[model samples]
Target: MVQEIRWGIVGLGSIAHTFAKDLALVTGGTLTAVASRSLEKAKAFAGEYGVAHTFDTYDALFESKEVDVVYIATPHTSHEALSIRAMENGKHVLCEKPMGVNPDQVARMIAVAEKNKVFLMEALWSRFNPSIRKAKQLVESGEIGSVGFVHADFAFYALNRDPDNRLLNPDLAGGSLLDIGIYPIFLSYLLLGMPKNIQASSHLYKTGVEMQTSMIFDYEGAQAILYSGLNSKSEMKAEISGSEGSIFLSPRWHEAQGYSIEKEGELVDYNLPTKGKGYTYEIEEVHSCLASGKVQSSMWSHRNSVDLARLLYEVRQKSNIIFPFEQQKEGV
Candidate 1:
């Protein structure tokens, strides 16, 4: 019989609820605990998910013996500290994207995880999506033949949202770049690796967070054009063009269910549906890594998180987009 991996969730936000529901679908994982600043909120979430433990503080959850691993779904600014705390307490961690607000925090998180000998992975679920895996395989197999350019955009209108909301608050590291833009950037990096150069621009909100951002990643012989924004809605599509053929990831590309390959003017569609809000794939990855006694996922390693954070840092630097906390940290 396989030993169950007991899981703790460090935030009771909507994303955490989604993760909890998906955790139920993983065979060797159990949602043993959840934490929130409010004990009432934690209890409510735990009751909804049948979790046996609840904590009013993140530190309590980290120290709980019921939790073997923690899913850090807190705000971007809190990820580094919470992940390190969990690792220091002998718990593995799967942190949400952006991992940290910047590269330095990511490095610290990685260092602590390494020192503690606990598994740590960024929960970039799209990387584990079946359709994305297929797309990568097709590109690697030369089906796209000498890929030359890729374009992706993720955008949604949040103009009417409250200024204090996380999406609009610089204090929370809110911005399209760190939120939605990371998806497009990830696609570019996965296919092209680090770029030779990065060119970026952004429209900042009155609160100082980026409202919309555009980026161009120049590679040796290829380029990726990416965009993300909160003032408009995009088709949320991604395309890869090559000398021989092209491939298209259907709408909402990041959480894509299918893709198409074009060759000789013929387009063939391949639909690969996901299971359980698509968070299940990453959950299963954590389970597989723990079962293998690994300290980091081979699919999305600690180095990958650092590299991704560095890219985000570069983009923000070029765009003059800095979170309030970062400025405070620098005494700006």
Candidate 2:
């Protein structure tokens, strides 16, 4: 039998809760520790997940010998510092998306991980979705016939809540583009690769953050029309059209339970049932890579994380959306 991989969750936030629940259903994985700034939250999370340890501080968890891998679920601004610290403590890291506020921080995290000879990955969970995998397979098999155009959007209304929430707080790197917008941006990179050129526009909130944003990614013969916002809901389905036909991801494409293919005037739909909050697949990938002694996954490597960060940084530049943390870097 394969030895179980012990995992630590650093941050008992909403997303962390989802990950912990999903970890329960995955083989070769167990939630061994949880950490949070608040002792109460950490203790509660540990009890709920039956985790063996709880730490009031992330540093405490990182130093725990029981945790072999640490999942960094903190805000975008804290990802780089926390992940690098975890690596320094000899722990593998799977950090949340937008890995950092910008490319520089991501580069630092990657450098630290490489220096430590530890495994590291950005938790872009959508890449592990079965429906997404099928879409990639269809495109690669020439079923899409030279993909030409792609369209995707992710949006929701979240402006009425606390103004201090992460979405509106520039200090926390808040904005639709970095938050909800990353889903569409990631989908574009997955199917279309990085665009050769780009143009973007945005509507800024009173808090000096982007409320809604749209962009067109231009390739040699293909283009991607993508949009994200915090003002309203969008259809959330994604389509990739080529010379022949297209693939349409079911509604809530990022968390899709199904997908459809339109080819030769025929339509076929597929259902993909997942075991948990859709995190089981990524957790499985982690287990497979660790068992093989691989440092980075071919599916989601350091290069992919860097490329995605650069693309977002460029897009934010075009949209004139700058995070306060970015300004701090410039000052330094």
lDDT of 2 by residue, 180-289 (tens): 88888898899878899988999999999999989999998999999999999999999999999999999899988989889899999989876787988899999998
Q: After superposition, how far is residue 206 of candidate 1 from its true place, in Å?
A: 1.1
TM-scores of the models, in the given order? 0.99, 0.98
| Candidate 2: residue 241 Cα off by (Å) | 0.7
Lowest lDDT sum, 10 consecutive residues, model 1, at 320-329
Off by over 4 Å in 2: none
> Which residue pairs in candidate 2 have backbone atoms (N, alpha carbon, C) closer than 3 angstroms, thus clashing?
none
Identify the candidate with maximal lDDT.
1
Off by over 4 Å in 1: none
Q: For candidate 1, lDDT tens digit of each residue in 79-122? A: 98999999999999999998988999999999999899999999
